[model samples]
Target chain A: MNGDLSALPGIVALTLGVGAVATAAMLAPAVALGFCLARGNFRGKALVQALVAVPMVLPPVAVGFALLILLGRNGPLAFVWSALDIDLVFSWWAAVIAAAVVGFPLLTRACEQAFGEVDVRFEQVARSLGLGPLRSFFAVTLPLARRGVLYGSLLAFTRALGEFGATALVAGIIPGRTETLALGIYSRVQLGDESGALALCAASFAIALIAMLVAEGWLRRSRP
Target chain B: MSQRTSRIRCHIDRPGFSLDVDVGWDERVAVVFGPSGSGKSTLFEIVLGLERCAGAHIRIGGSTFDDEAAGLYLPTECRDLGWVPQSPTLFPHLSVSENLDFGRARAADRDPAARKRAIEVLEIGDLLGRSIDQLSGGEAQRVAIARALASGPSALLLDEPLAALDLPLRARVLPYLMRVRDQLDLPILYITHDPDEAQLIGDIIVVLDAGRIVASGAPRDVLWSRAVLPLSEALGLENVFEGGIRREHGSPTFVSNAGLQLVLPVSLDGDTRVRIGLRAEDVVLAADRPGKISARNVLESRVIACDDRDGDVYVSLDAGEKLVAKVTAAAAAQLALAPGSTVYAIVKAQALRRLG
Candidate 1:
């Protein structure tokens, strides 16, 4: 019990730090995809939408295998990996890439719905007031959709914190290198370490519960 | 150089209908009056550069904003024109002051005097701190207009800005619109379907029907024209006259166009030219000149046309001008009225209402 307690601070820090980086890396692409899905009209739009939805519907293991094929030592980018003299696999960066891939869809769908609900006439009015399109979007549309964006980022962060299957496959369970809270919990359970598993589970539940509460409060405050 | 005139010539082809119009204006308030689906809004959208138009040529203040032949097309932001749509578009996420400042910040001129004048004219100083959702419909509209004005556009386009308000609210907002037109020195293109609104503020009136300009002139001239009489008749204002108030035999009278004089109960104090409207039901028709009638005014007229409407006969008469009289078919048969038949149209002085 004392040993598990001693390891708690390090586990929490690793989970939070990795989750934040994964969410930040996914932010711009998620917002752009959300806006396009909500407002754009183009050929193959349905195909693009279906492609974005794959990560949400597919099993987490399948996503992990796909990433391994792309970033593994003998994978597609072997030459670049050799040139950089650093392997991405079994590293903290591998965990972030895995978490970002898995968490992207939730962020995108939430933001898409938010942007869809905004009236286009408001943007048009802004343009008529001498604002260019991009300026109007930032001035009018983005502020109106801020609540959804925040909610989506929180959801993505939470998803990243609990990421296990993809991170295990790509980043491996190296305790001090890449083992997140979720992976730590799994490794402890597999090794029959009951006390460590329980502690990690309690910590995960606390973080997720706090995230949900904050999200609910944020949505209420920002609703128009 | 002569005072610049705004000219618009455009052709917009839609699925079920197309709009083609050529018009020019230099008036302080140029009103676009039309029925629903008459392409009035489409015309405004084209001028604002929000909707694409083929072969569009728009020039304001001697600068060409859009000319297909000249291959010139400016975007909405570059056109420098303010727009107030029918609904109040105060940004939901902003306070009144912040919304107003949004436009002020983007204005090329950015004159503090103009911003101050707009805020004062709209009377929205007290609402600066209020959120958009807290405002009444009339207050929101005032804010929208003020925001547009703060942009310092050379012209303003108002698309039925008061149509969403109830009657009392519309009345309250109208004075501010008039002030903006009269005091701002900015040309305004006002679109509306309400005849009263068109008559009240229009320096030049353009009537559109079926996506075409039916008539364009001064309000009185267009409203009283033969092309517009049927529209007014359908709107229940059967007798519309523009005339000068005069004193005859120590009594007040109204002398209308075509040299027809009408006895009035009271004289207008200031205005010489007055617009008077009477309902069709108010005019009593007689085949022969009646001897003892309480009605104070009578006109010798010729019956021009008659139509049956819901068991009543709507008789059209030329009493030195066009007039409509609603009488029963039985009464028309008893009087033996027909085309070119001479008749006397009797109306009471109290029945005449000052329309504008």
Candidate 2:
């Protein structure tokens, strides 16, 4: 027990930043995929849905290993990374990639459920009012499904903040860099810093609580 | 009138149902009248280009929306026709004004003027600030109509706009629809199962049954035509008489716009102008004027046509206004009824129901 607590702020900031970045990065794709799943009727739809849920159901470590193989040297697309002169392993971006992969299923599932709850008639009415397909979705369908999407985003953000196995595998727990709250807690407990681990736990709990409270307030306020 | 024409020739095949209709009319207001499963809404969907039917030809107000032969099909948004679907589909997330603006924003021309006219004609001005859920059934329908009209469409397509409302609410909303019909010069394609609504709102009634156009012509003539008697009788075809009430000899006398007078069973307190409904079955036909009959009203009417089908005879008559009487085939034969036969239409005052 060194009784040193100076690394707390850096770890908290890195954790929050990683969660925010990863959630932001996945927002558009998740919404698009979710809407497609909710409304589309096509061949191979079941296979697509199953593939989307694979990340959520599979072990996070396995996902990290797969991502590691894809982004690591001596793997496919290795020349692209080498050409770009970028090393992705054990970096902040690697942690974001890991968090995004793990949190994607939660966000997408939420979006699909939310969009499914919206009546297609609203979109049809919007289209009949001279709005194109894209405009109708934004003006009618998306707003109607906002609560579910927002709630799903908060779920993914919290999941990203707590991402441990995937982040640890792809992005090693480097001090003041790739280390987040969950990784910090694991590393602190392993190093016999019980107080540090407890502090990180409290921070995680506080962040999860505040994010949910804000989302609930927003959802209630915007309820039709 | 510019001799506007609306035409729809489409064949839609669905599981356990098929809609094969070819109907066209020169009237500005063409109504698709039918029973519940008669594909009235489906026909509307085809006209709006919402339902894609290959080789379907839909032309409204001289504008072609779908002509599959020419390989041209305008999407629903590009149809440039105001469509009020069967249900009131006001956007729940928006206020009434926002919903109106949603349509007005995309209007090609007369943006503000169209919006203003829609708001005024539908009488939804006071309801503009309210949310959709806060509105009553009638108010929501009015707002829905206004929203459609605000788009400045070349024509309007209404799918049973008053079907969702109760009787009183329908009455309250129908005048707004009538005002829309009278005030706006746009061609209207209205749909309904109610014969009265068909008679009142539609200049040309296209009777549909089993996903087919049974008859299409002038409202009264087509509705009472031999071709439409079976379907119209099943729909409970009602003679809709529009008139005013005045106290004659201490009793309220109902005088229709067409100069037919009748005694009322119940005296209405207020509102002199009213519409009454008389069912075909409620009208009893007598070969001779009955002396000392308990029935309140008796009028001599010339038979236009007698359709004997399914063990009943439907006598189409001209008793000042067009009226129908359903009598047994035996009674029809006993009276030797046929076209140009002089008969008496005995209508009990109690049989008349105040529609509005």
DockQ of each: 0.64, 0.73
List of clashing residue pairs for candidate 2: none
Instruction: Summing lDDT over every window of 10 consecutive residues in candidate 2 chain B, give the lowest-scoring window.
Output: B265-274
- Model 1 per-residue lDDT tens digits across residues A1-224: 43357887898899999999999999999998999999998999899889998998898888988888788779888888888988888899999999999999989988898899899889889999888999998999988999989999999999999998988998898887788899999889888888898999999999999999999999888847
Docking quality of model 1: it rates as medium
Tens digit per residue, CA lDDT, model 2, A174-209: 998899999989998999989989988888889989
lDDT of candidate 1 over B148-194, digit per residue (tens): 99888778889998889987687568768867877888878899887
| lDDT at B136, model 2 | 94
Q: Judge candidate 2 at residue B322 and give its lDDT.
A: 75
Model 2 stretches with alpha carbons more than 4 Å out: A1-3, B1-4, B108-111, B247-250, B265-273, B286-296, B329-343
TM-scores of the candidates in the order shown: 0.82, 0.93
Query: Per-residue lDDT tens digits of candidate 2, residues B258-310?
Result: 98877887554235767788888899988889999878889899999888878
lDDT of each: 0.84, 0.87
